[model samples]
Target: MARRAIDEGYKVRCLVRSSKKAAFLKEWGAELVPGNLRYPDTLAEALVGVTQVIDASTSRPTDSLSIKQVDWDGKVALIQAAKAAGVERFIFFSILDADKYPEVPLMEIKRCTELFLAESGLNYTILRLAGFMQGLIGQYGIPILESQPVWVTGNSSPIAYMDTQDIAKFAIRALSVPETQNQTFPVVGTRAWSAEEIINLCERLSGKDARVTRMPITLLRAVRGLMRFFQWGWNVADRLAFTEVLASGKELNASMDEVYTIFGLDPQQTTTLESYLQEYFSRIMKKLKELDYQKNKNKNKKEKPKKTPFKQSSKANSQ
Candidate 1:
């Protein structure tokens, strides 16, 4: 995002918790400002001299951060600061059906933030995105295939999986486009793929065998009940809720033409889920190989006996 913003000739300042984490961005002509979204006071300096704010911050239920901290209170603080600073535009990246599913914690928090932004008197553009192809491969790929040929989930449902690049491109275009002001964009990919199709595609693209096992709705409901009773990790509960919702055949469909109409680029030009699966798996394999090399190198270092200095050094010095 910072890269695209910089390429678009905007002065980009990133609010990150660790300066070291964002140091590379500084080399790319971005100002890395140390700040924490969970703390409102830390964001004031970052918001200064900034005309526009793009909020992509989200909180996972399992992480140290909570929905209230990052999604609701943090965003509210940022919006308030932006309003005080007279910032003109605030673009928020949110989840689809955020307002519709208040029962889900993350969605409820996101909806609250959206409402807060709307009433903050700042021009806003809310991008509601569905399942992300990159997210699927990065977060769930290994988990799905680890030590198992089959992964169980709710009934097969088609979800609009947008490429991260497409989302970034749309956001970059929306940054300067006046027509996008005060409008909400339902950002999704041109294609919808079911979970079974995704599993098959992953296997085909990576040349690995895997299977999708669908769990009955009753079982899913029982899982949800357990999650509520035990207060399962927020991430787990969130995933269960999403899976249950999708299994009900709730379509996250979006108009592909809308992306072209708004961003002036054909969605067909972007990467497809199949292509992304290939690329993502290839990258993961490369990383694994690198890690294996490093592990061997470290093992050799530890296993190899350290040589004692030759006693001849004293005799040589005397000679």
Candidate 2:
């Protein structure tokens, strides 16, 4: 998104906690602001001379910063600052059906921020995106690539997956289009697929078998409760919570016509889940080939006969 904004001639300013980590964005023509969303005082200077605000921030379930701090309270602070700065538009990348899942902590937090943005009295564009295919490539695709069984807590349900690149394209469109102002758009993929289907597709693409273990939802809930009671690490507990959310069997499918009508995307041009998974598999295969090359190179080096140093015998020395 930052890159797209820069390519389109927008003066990109990134609010980053670590400037060093964002050095690439800086080199790519983005003005980096050393600020933390948890701290509102730092946002004033960041928002200065800012016309549009695009927030792609989300709190991790396992992170030290709770949803209230970063997603809720921090976003509130950012919105207030943007409003104060007289920002023309605020574009927020939010989760799909955030209000529908109150039991899910992160979803509830998103709902709160969505409401706040709607009432902030500033022009805003809320992009309710489904699961990002790019993110799933790491979480799901990597494990499958490693030949590890992916554990699921419920029946293999269909999930709508969108490419982050497509979402960013729509975001860029929102900035220039007047119709997108003060509107909430469901930015989803053109197709939906079940996890089992995704696994199958990947297996076919890579010519490798993928094992998916479907555990009972009840068991997952029990384990999650036990983890909490026994004080397990936040990362583990949070991952379990996320798994439960996925297992809840809530389909994230939405109308693709919305994107077509709003963002002017041709249905044929949109990326499919199968295509993304194929690309991910190709990347993993490339890495595996590199590893195999390195292994072979090392083995050849070790197997090569070592040359012995020339030495003079006692009889030769006497001669």
Per TM-score, the best of the predicted structures is 2
**Which sections of candidate 2 miss by over 4 Å?**
226-244, 305-319
Ten contiguous residues with the weakest lDDT in model 1: 143-152
Score candidate 2 by lDDT.
0.82
Q: Evaluate model 1: give its TM-score.
A: 0.80
lDDT of 1: 0.77
Candidate 2, residue 253: the lDDT equals 76
Q: Report lDDT (Cα) of residue 168, candidate 1.
A: 83
lDDT string for model 1 (118-141, tens) is: 888899999988888866864347
Highest lDDT: give the candidate number.
Answer: 2
Question: What are the clash counts of all predictions, listed in order?
Answer: 0, 0
Lowest lDDT sum, 10 consecutive residues, model 2, at: 230-239
